[model samples]
Target: MNLPNILTLSRIVAIPVIIFLFLTGNPVAQWFAFALYVIAAITDFFDGALARRMNAVSPLGRMLDPIADKLLVGALLIAFAFAGSFTTGLTWAAIAIMMREIAVSGLREHLGSEGVTVHVTAIAKYKTMTQLIALGAMLVVPLVPGLELAAHGLVWLAAVLTVYTGVEYFMKAWPHLSGAKV
Candidate 1:
């Protein structure tokens, strides 16, 4: 495996440790989780850049990159939800985000099988950025003053972007989504 793929795999390896740290309920553990998360998030950017710069992109990296991202983001969201980080009535926002992720993933897989490619959109990249920022803040909410509010705002913003991107992806792939392949 190349450096980029190794970095991607490292992210996948770090998810459970991050979740463990968050679950421990200690401030130090939370900080550790936050650090791990930030490192992982940074790797997401570098792996892609390195892959392109070094001409080392592979089908395996393409498949595992998103899986690693989903694992990291999904674990953080579920942990935060369990910790009651979301608003009283806004838990559905998290659910909506998760549902959209799964739907889009499934849609992408279905299309891939049909010889159709679904590319990442600029909006979706923004959604990822907001999501990582939101989740990072949420993970470290106790460490910073007034950050919980900011974290919630980021989450809401990410949700809006997520929904919009989901719609955009659906519309773009609607032609392929139809027919017996769907």
Candidate 2:
């Protein structure tokens, strides 16, 4: 009910609209989607900050924030893959990122159920930023013809970070998974 939670919810709401915009294959609609995405991403950052500042953090916010993030990123990645927006040979990068997301989410849930807490590492935060930047760059590729190389580069870079953080998270949970003492 607070502003922070509202912001988190807004991102989930924006996903379908954004995807529909991309599907239209209209430059203007895509640009609108890009704009909406930028706004949604900004809300991602602010929701947590505002929650802390206002002393209004709630379990609902906690549960929804990460879900919102995964949905937004996952949906955009899938949209780009299906739209063939990624450069040939670069679609694997998108697959890698999506795989990492799913793997890590499953890991977290498993650990949580086992009374183990796995925190978000600093590097993972950077991975998220890189992913958002790469996705944003990809959104502009059609409208900005010369951006293909840069967009593809960003996607590759994001994929590397995604895999790295994913491994780091997995290693952190290795002991628990192996039933060894933590």
The candidate scoring highest on TM-score is: 2
lDDT of 2 by residue, 1-182 (tens): 99999999999999999999988999999999999999999998999999999999998999899889899989998898889887656788888888999999999989989888889899998898898899899988889979999989998999999999999999888999998987
- RMSD for all candidates, in order, please: 1.9, 1.0
TM-score between candidate 2 and the true structure: 0.97
- Tens digit of per-residue lDDT, candidate 1, span 1-182: 89999999999999999999988989999899989989999999999999999999999899999888888888888988788777764477787788888888998999899898999998899899899998998888878888888888888888888888888899989877666455
List the candidates' TM-scores in order.
Answer: 0.95, 0.97
Q: Which residue pairs in candidate 2 have backbone atoms (N, alpha carbon, C) closer than 3 angstroms, thus clashing?
A: none
**Distance from true location, Cα of 114 in model 1, Å:** 0.7
Name the TM-score of candidate 1.
0.95
Give stretches of model 1 more than 4 Å off: 180-182
